[model samples]
Every structure is written in C-alpha cells, then in structure tokens.
Target: MELNSDQIKEILPHRYPFLLVDRITACEPGKYADGRKCVSVNEMQFCGHFPQQAVMPGVLVLEALAQTGAVALLTEEENKGKLVFFGGVKQARFRKQIVPGDVIELHTEIIARKGPVGFGKATATVDGKIAVSAELSFAIAEPESRN
Candidate 1:
C-alpha cells in the first residue's frame, strides 16, 4: 500500500524538522517499506551544517531509513499506536553527500523481530546510488502520555 504525508504522520511519531520521510511509496506491513524524502535547501539543518556547501547530515539519513522501517513495523495490525525507539545503529556507512534537490529513496526490511525489539536492514539512495546504509536496531514502546 502507498501512504502520503498525512498517513505517514499517523504512523510515525516524529514531527517537523525531524519527520524526515515524506511519503511511503510501497509497503508490506511488518515486512518492508519504500519511502522518499525531497531534500530542500531551506531545511533548518542546512543553515548550520554549512553555509557555503550544504549537505544533509548522515545521521539524519539513518534516521530517515529507520523511520521508513518504523512505518512497516508500526503498520502491522497488532502494532498500531506503539512508538518505535532506537536501540542502536549498527554498521552504518555514508557513501554520498545528500544535498538540496536530492530526492532520497529509502528502503527498509525487517530482518528480525522478537517481542518489542527488532532489527532492520535499511538504505537511502539518490539517483540509484546508495547515500547511506545501515542495520538498525529498534524497540517498540509505549508512547509517553501527557496529563
């Protein structure tokens, strides 16, 4: 199934400036997902990351990858409303500098899952070249409630 930004918002906990994934192009709940982000020069990070030559932060790329995976995990019928958190990031590598106008294609597959903890294989690519790749470890947890 495909999801737009509003649907993505319902599945992901992140918000503006941090909600990296713009849309999900394909997905099989709890198995895999394909998402995308349209990089913009006006994003806040570019202001400080560099004034002369702006580049999307490598860590954020990983976060986007993880969040793409989260959409898959959280979309499972049994997992609705649960929040996903980073347990750790493993074997992460960045091969390209993502910049404004670069449309990142993020792909993620759940590699393992047991109870609340899981691992996903993820990659972010631009123009068919991988910009970043990683094995992401994450946990399903209760969303913090406000009084």
Candidate 2:
C-alpha cells in the first residue's frame, strides 16, 4: 500500500522537523516497506549541524528507516495505538554523507518478532547506492510510559 503524508501521520506520532519518513511507497505487513525522505536545507537541524557542510545526521537516517519499519509493524490491528521505541542498533555503517536535496529511499525488512519486541534490517539509499545500513531492534511501549 502507498501511504501519503496524512496517512503517515496517522501511523506515526512524530511531527514536523522530526517526522522523517515523508511517504511510504510500498508496504507489506510483517515483511517489509519502502519509504522516502526528502532532505532539505531548510530543515531545522541544518542550521546548526555544521553550516559549512550540512550533512543529514546518520542517527536521523536510521530513525527515518526505523520509522518506516514502525509503520509497517504498527499498521496491524494488534499493534495499533502502541509506540515502537528503539531497543538496539547493531552493525550500523554510513557509507556516504547525505546532504541537502538528497532523496533517501528507506527499505526495512523484518527479521524476527517475539512478543512486543521486533528486529529488522534497514537501509538508506540514494540513487540505488547505499548511504547507510543497520540492524535494528524495537519494542512496543504503552503510549503513556517511557521504557
């Protein structure tokens, strides 16, 4: 399924300046999803994250990819209303710097699911070349609790 920004908002709790995944191009429940995040110079983070050479932070790239995974995981009836939080990140690598005007294609595939915890591998690509990749784990948390 393709999800626009509004639908993405419905699936994710993040707001502007923080909401990374701009749109979901494809999604398959319990399997994988493809999304895009258009990086712009006007983003709030760009003002301070090195003005001379603004690079999209690697952490936000992971977060963007993870958010795509969260959308895939949370869209299910059983996972709705639950907040997916980062549990762990392993084997993270940044191959290239992502700068303004770059459109990052995020791909995430679920590796395993045990109760409220899930594991997946996510990658960020530009022009079909990998910019960053990581193995990520997430846990579903109640809306009111921080864990």
Candidate 3:
C-alpha cells in the first residue's frame, strides 16, 4: 500500500517542519514500510546546520526512520489511532552525509513485539547508498487528552 503526505499525517501526529517523511512508497501495516524524505535547502535545519554547506542533520534522518517504523506498527487494526514513542535506538551508524536535493529512502521492518512494545530494524538511503542504519525500539501508547 502507498500513502501520501496527508494520509501519513492521519497516522502520525507530526506536522509542518517536523513532519519529515514526505511520502510512503510501500507499507505492510504491521510488517514494514518504505518512505521518502525530500531534503531541501529551504528546510529550517539547513538554515543553521551550515549556511555555507547545508547538510541534513543526522538526528532528523533517524527520526525519519522512526516515523517509517511507526507507520508500519500504527497501521495495524489494533494500533490505529495510537501513538508510538521511541523507547531506544541501538547500533546506529551514519555512513554518508545527506544534503539538499537528496531524496532519503527510509525503510523499517518490525522485527519483534511483546504487547505494546516492539523493535524495528531501520535504514535510510540516498542515491542507493546507505546514509544511516539503526535498530529502533518503540512503545505504543494512548494519545494524551488535548483538554
């Protein structure tokens, strides 16, 4: 299944400058998800990260991977409307610098689960080269009341 930015917003709470994933190219509910993030010089991070040499922050790349994993877990029928919070990240490695005009391809697969907590294997690639790879842990939680 594929999801547009609007559809992704329905599954994720993030918005505006914080919503890093621009599109989900493939998704398998509780199994895995493949998404994309189009880096741009106009992004707020680029303004300060390095005005002379803009580079996408490594943390944001990890966040994009997390969001892709969340989409995989949250799409399940039992998880709909729930929120997934980062429990931990492990074995994270940055192999390349992501810059403006790069299209980050994010992929995540649910590797294990026990009730509300689970683990995922994630990777972010640019131009077919691995930019970041990590193991992410997450916990499903009820959304807090707005009022």
Candidate 4:
C-alpha cells in the first residue's frame, strides 16, 4: 500500500530534519517494504557533511533503511504506538556516495522474528544501482504510559 507523509508519521516517531523517508511506495506487513528519501540541499546534515561537495553520509542511508523497516513493522495494528529501536547492524557496506538531489530507494525484507525483536536485510539504491546494503536488527518498546 502507498503511504503518504502523514500516514508515515503515524507509523514512525521521527520528525522533520530527522525523518529520512518521504513516502512508502509499497509495504507488506511482517514481510517487506519499499520507500524513498529525497535528498535535498536544505537538509541540516548538508551543512556539516561538506560545504563544497555535500554527500549524504553512509550511516544516514542505513538509518533510512532502518526507518523503512520500522514502518513496515509498526504499521500493523498489533504494533502501533510502540517504538522500534535499533538493536544491531551487520555486514553494512557503502558502495557509492549519495548527494543532494538523489532519490534513494530503500528496499527491506524481514529475515527473522523473535517476540518483540526482528531482523531484516535492507538495500538502498540510486538509479537502480546499490548505494548501501546491510543486515539490521531491532526491538519494539512500549512506552511506560501505554503499558
């Protein structure tokens, strides 16, 4: 299903300047998700990343992938209102630099699930070429007030 920014905000906790994903193109509960982040010169990170030649950091790209996975997990009615926190990351690699004006496509697939924790394999691409890939794990946290 396609998700707009407002719908995405309902599923994710991140806000502007930190919310990396702009929208979700596709999603399958407990399975996989595809989303995109439009890198722009107005981003706060652009100022410090490099003044002359700003490049989106590799870590941020990975975070974007993770956020996509979180949206996949949290959009389910059973997981709503829970916070998805990064547990770990493995075999992360950056194949190319992502700069302003690039549209990054993130594809994530679930690899494993155990109670409140889940694992996923994600890839970020630009123009059909991979820019980053990684195996990531996360855990769901229910805020104290919700419990």
Candidate 5:
C-alpha cells in the first residue's frame, strides 16, 4: 500500500527539516520499501550550503535511504512504536549532486536481520541514475515511556 507524509509520520519520528521521506510508493513489512523526496529551493539547508550552489548534502540523502529502510522494518507489527537508530554505514558512495526540483527516489532492501539489529542495502536515485548507495546498519528500540 502507498503512504502519504501523514501516514509516514505514524511510523517515523522525524519531522520538518529532518523528515526526508515524502511519500512511500511501495512497502513490504520486513523486506523493502521505496519512497521519494521532492527537493525544494526553499529548504533551509540551501540558505548556507553554498548559497549560489545549493547541493543537497550526501548524508541527508543517505538518511533518506535509511528512512526508507526504516519504513520497511517498522511496518512489521512487532516493531511498532519503536525508533530505528543509525548503527553504521558501509561503503557509502555519492555519484550525483541532488538539488532543488530534483525528485530523490529511495529504495532499500533488507540484507540481514537479527533480533533488533539489521542491515540494509540502500540506494537513492534521481532521474533514474543512482545519486548515492550504501549498506546501512540499524538498531531498533522502544521509545522511552512517558510515565
């Protein structure tokens, strides 16, 4: 099933400038997910990230990829109401500079799964060319109880 930003918010804690995933076009619990982010010139980062050349940061691109993986992981019933933390990144590569008006398509696959820790192979593409790729490690945990 597809999900809009509001539905995405129900699964991920990130919001505003940090909420990179805009819409999920495909998702399979514990398997994989595909989402997109529409880069806008009005984004805050563009203000200082080389004023004249507002290139989207590579790290944020990878975060978007990770967030795509998180959507797959968190969609599982057992992982609900949990947070997925960045455990590590392996062999990350950025091949393109993402900018305003670009639509970043994020795709991720579950490579390994063990308890609360898992690994995902993620890729971000723009106009059908890979912009970034990485192997992301993640650790899932329950949110702190408010009580």
Candidate 6:
C-alpha cells in the first residue's frame, strides 16, 4: 500500500526536522517498505554541516534507512503503537553524496526477526544510484508515556 506523509506519521514516531521519510511508496507489513525523502537546502543540517558545500550526513542517511525499516515493523498487528529503536548498524557503506534537490529512494526489507529484535537490509538511492546501504538492527519496545 502507499502512504502519504500524514499516514506515515501515524506509523512513525518522528516529527518535523527529524521525520526523513517524506512518503512511503510501498509497504508490506512485517516484510518491507519503500519510501522517499526530498532533500532541501534549508534543512538544519546544511546550516552547520557545510555552509559552502552542503551535503547530507551519512549518519542521517542511516537513520532514514532505519526509519524506513521501522515502518515495516510497526505496521504489523503485533507491533502497532510500539517504538523501534536502533540496536546497531552493520556493513554500512556510503556510495555517493546526497545533495539538495535530490530525492532519495529508501528501501528496507526485514530479513530476520527474533522476539522484539529485527534485522533489515536497507539502501538509499538517488537517481538510481546508491547513496548509502547498510544492514540495520532494531529493538521494538513500548513508547514511554509523556506524562
């Protein structure tokens, strides 16, 4: 199924400035998710990351991948309303630079699961070229009450 930003918010806990996935193009609960992120020059990171030559940070790219994977995990009936935290990242590779105006294609597949932990193979591409790829680990847990 496809999901817009609003619908994505219902599944992801992140909000403005942090919600990297702009739209979920495809999703299969407990299996995989494909999303997109439109990078802008006005983003906060660009302010300090490099004023002269702005570039999307590699770590944020990894986080985006993780968030994409989280969408797949959170949509499952058994995981709804839960939060997915980053357990670890493995085999992360930065293949190309992502710049403003670039629309990153995020894809993540849940390759394995053990209890509340899940392993995902993820990749971020721009214009059909890989910008980043990694094996991500996630730990699912209930969200803490605000009050």
Q: What TM-score fits each model?
A: 0.97, 0.95, 0.98, 0.96, 0.97, 0.98
Off by over 4 Å in 5: none
Per-candidate Cα lDDT values, in order, are 0.93, 0.92, 0.95, 0.92, 0.94, 0.95
* Candidate 3 local distance difference test against the native: 0.95
Badly placed stretches (over 4 Å) of model 6 are: none
lDDT by residue for model 3 (1-147), tens: 999999999999999899999999999999999999999988999889999999899999999999999999999999999999988999999999999999999999999999899899999999999999999999999999988
RMSD of each: 0.8, 2.0, 0.7, 1.5, 0.9, 0.8
Better of 3 and 4 by lDDT: 3
> Tens-digit lDDT track for model 2 on 32-100?
889999999999889989899999999999999889999889887788888889888999999999999
For model 5, the run of ten residues with the poorest summed lDDT: 44-53
Instruction: For residues 1-147, write the lDDT of model 5, one tens digit per residue.
Output: 689999999999999989999999999999999999999999988998869889998988989999999999999999998999988899999999999999999999998998899999999999999999999999999898898
RMSD of 1: 0.8
- Least accurate stretch of 10 residues (summed lDDT) in model 2? 138-147
For candidate 4, the lDDT comes to 0.92
Better of 2 and 4 by TM-score: 4
Q: What's the true lDDT of residue 37 in model 3? A: 97
lDDT of 4 by residue, 84-113 (tens): 998889999999899999999999888899
What is the overall TM-score of model 3 with all chains considered together?
Answer: 0.98
Q: lDDT of model 4 at residue 124?
A: 99
- Model 4: CA > 4 A from native: none
